[model samples]
Target: MRITADRTRCVGSGLCAERLPDVFDQDDDALVLLCADEVPAGLRQDVEEAVQRCPTEALSLDADAPEH
Candidate 1:
């Protein structure tokens, strides 16, 4: 899995970082940064939640396996 942020679309909501700090980080602009691409060993749920909470739809995850 790979997580990335579309800076062009990010609204600086920080929702992803607040909800999943382990996976998401924010730049000075408040846009979330991807801590890693692959979904960590056991943080799938958190990642999903973050994606869902992204106000600007800027946070996106690409998983080798469909989200389960």
Candidate 2:
């Protein structure tokens, strides 16, 4: 899975960073960065949790994931 965040929609809640530190990093501007070029199997659960935990719905994953 490929993770994404809508920078414009983010509210700096930091839930994504709390839930998925490996996949998401918070910048000084308070927007989270998506670190994964390709989803790693071990990080999938945390990635999903981060997406779900995003209060503004800013976090997302590509719906059409490439075959792993």
Candidate 3:
């Protein structure tokens, strides 16, 4: 799956980063930062959870997208 984060929509909740450090992180300003553009096969579930748990709806996952 492909993971996208809208930095502008981020509220710096750190939920995504805290739950999936491998795929998400916080910048110096604490806004959401994507550690990877594509989600690994094994981490799809975790990425989906992060997207849903994002307080500001800044995270998105495209399961139909082709892998890089």
Candidate 4:
């Protein structure tokens, strides 16, 4: 799966980072940062959870897309 975030829609809530630190993080300004755009199979489930928990719906996953 591939994941991306829309910064304009983010609220700096940090929930994604909290739920999946290995794939998400907060910059110095506390904006959401994607640590891994091309998710490995092992981390797909956790990444999906993070996307679902995003309050502002800033996180997105393209599960059907071909891996880059």
Instruction: Judging by lDDT against the true structure, name the best candidate.
Output: 3
lDDT of 4 by residue, 1-68 (tens): 78899988988999998888888889888889988888766887788888899999999998798844
Encode model 1's per-residue lDDT on 1-68: one tens digit a residue.
Answer: 77778889988888888877778889998876887777788998888888888878887777664654
lDDT of each: 0.81, 0.78, 0.88, 0.86
| Alpha carbon deviation, residue 8, candidate 2 (Å) | 0.5
Give me the displacement of residue 1 in model 4, in angstroms. Answer: 1.2
Least accurate stretch of 10 residues (summed lDDT) in model 3? 59-68
What TM-score would you give candidate 4 relative to the actual structure?
A: 0.87
Preferred candidate (lDDT higher): 3 or 4:
3
TM of each candidate vs. truth: 0.83, 0.81, 0.89, 0.87
Candidate 4 lDDT for residue 21: 86
Per-prediction count of colliding residue pairs?
2, 0, 0, 0
The parts of candidate 3 lying over 4 Å away from their true place are 66-68
RMSD of each predicted structure: 3.6, 2.0, 1.3, 1.3
Prediction 1 global C-alpha lDDT = 0.81
Model 2: colliding residue pairs: none
Q: Where is model 2 poorest over a 10-residue stretch in terms of lDDT?
A: 32-41
Better of 1 and 3 by lDDT: 3
Name the 10 consecutive residues with the lowest summed lDDT in model 1: 59-68
